[model samples]
Target chain A: MNSSSSGNVGIVIVSHSPKIAEGAADMVRQMVGNAVPLAWTGGDIDGGLGTNVAGILEAIETAWSPAGVAVLVDLGGAETNSEMAVEMLPEDRRARVVVCNAPVVEGAVIAATESSGGSPLAAVKRSAEEFYA
Target chain B: MHDAHASRPGETPVPLTASAVLVNKVGLHARPSIKLTQCAKGFTAKIELALAADGPWTDAKSPVKVMRVKAPQGATLHFRVAGPDGKAALAAVLALVHDGFGEV
Candidate 1:
């Protein structure tokens, strides 16, 4: 994982199950040393689309202390819900939001571990920069 | 450009690289792990995983690989792509991971 470390970067990871989110977070702490802010979401098995856009916005807003925040998600309903939450963010904060393309477990761990010294956004960017041409 | 609605034809894969960051407080578990594995299927790329030295890393596209790799909050993962649409595959994976899956 590689990218430019720019500003404060918080992170939100969504999944269809709460266990997945927790598991990813556990991995992240192992990697980056756990100085950054992180969150998680999981849909109910009943297909409740358990993602709370408003809650996410609130968490991002609160987490947006020094810099901004980035979001990562697994496939299925989580993707749709994540995209919707992005729209919910304020126009200005939108630029701060970054949606990565890595898997939930892998992405969370990388972002969490990489976000040190630099801004969370910067760390996240670094964690995500390798795919660019 | 390939049809957005139509699935792209399968072909030999190439290699690309992308990064994934964890944003959830709880971290990666069963539900998210499976979904991530499913997302990898969208691409024809061969995905491999590497953790941030202290964390777990495995095959990005395989559920079994994912299960083998175990990580918690604040971790980061490296995904190397090898397939037909390595670039696109890498991009998509990065986006999904960066977005935090819209979780709390």
Candidate 2:
């Protein structure tokens, strides 16, 4: 099931600060190149420091891959918002997504690298979660 | 202690082993640890790495265990690999370490 150019898994990063999310995405890109799909969203719709369900949903769509998608977020509220965004997706798509419990930056980089190697959603999530281990 | 030349008829030879000092400034940090783990996963050998000469060995495929070594710069890392591809795996890991994980 080829999706993007690389046909590997994708990653979505969510953070309370736009800069933090963008920075983490950039780090992932630097480490993994363009072989993996990567998208990120942060800050509220009004440009404040907070999470937005709509922005996260759009990011997930932007980085969507038939292989699957792993969402990494910063803090509990961001995680909550990310879960809500995933729930808003269609059942078929939602089932293919996972909200990883890992550090945002480290998880993004590790997930992207594993995904670039054509790992499945579960493997990618495990790699990211191992960041805490 | 057993004689170095002594060997049983069906016993497998001892594992191939090597040691190298971590020259990278950050030692086995997150990025380098990930790289090492990924490389180790490529081989079917049972690979293990220890921080010191006689330190406890941990599975090289486990990123968490590798990171837990916390080997700083100039710390010697000993590797023991046992399997069909043990020799090749040891060489590959040694090469990566000698290259300073491409950090320098």
The C-alpha lDDT values of all candidates are: 0.61, 0.85
lDDT of 2 at A111: 86
Against the true structure, what is model 1's DockQ? Answer: 0.03
User: What C-alpha lDDT, on a 0 to 100 scale, does residue A25 get in candidate 2?
Assistant: 89
Residue-level error in angstroms, candidate 2, position A2: 16
Model 2, global lDDT? 0.85
Top-DockQ candidate index: 2
Best by lDDT: 2
Regions more than 4 Å wrong, model 2: A1-5, A131-133, B1-14, B53-55
Top-scoring candidate (TM-score):
2
Please write out the lDDT profile of model 2 over residues B1-104, one tens digit for every residue.
34542364432368778899899999998778877877887778889999865758898876666877888999899999887677888999999999999997
**Per-residue alpha-carbon lDDT of model 1 for A54-73, expressed as tens digits?**
65565466446346666677
Q: Which ranges in model 1 have alpha carbons more than 4 Å from their true place?
A: A1-7, A44-50, A119-123, A129-133, B1-104
Writing each residue's lDDT as its tens digit, candidate 2 over A1-133 gives 1125566888999999999999998887766567788899999989999999999899989889998899999998799999999999999999999999999998888888778767789989998898676
Q: Give the count of colliding residue pairs in each prediction.
A: 86, 0
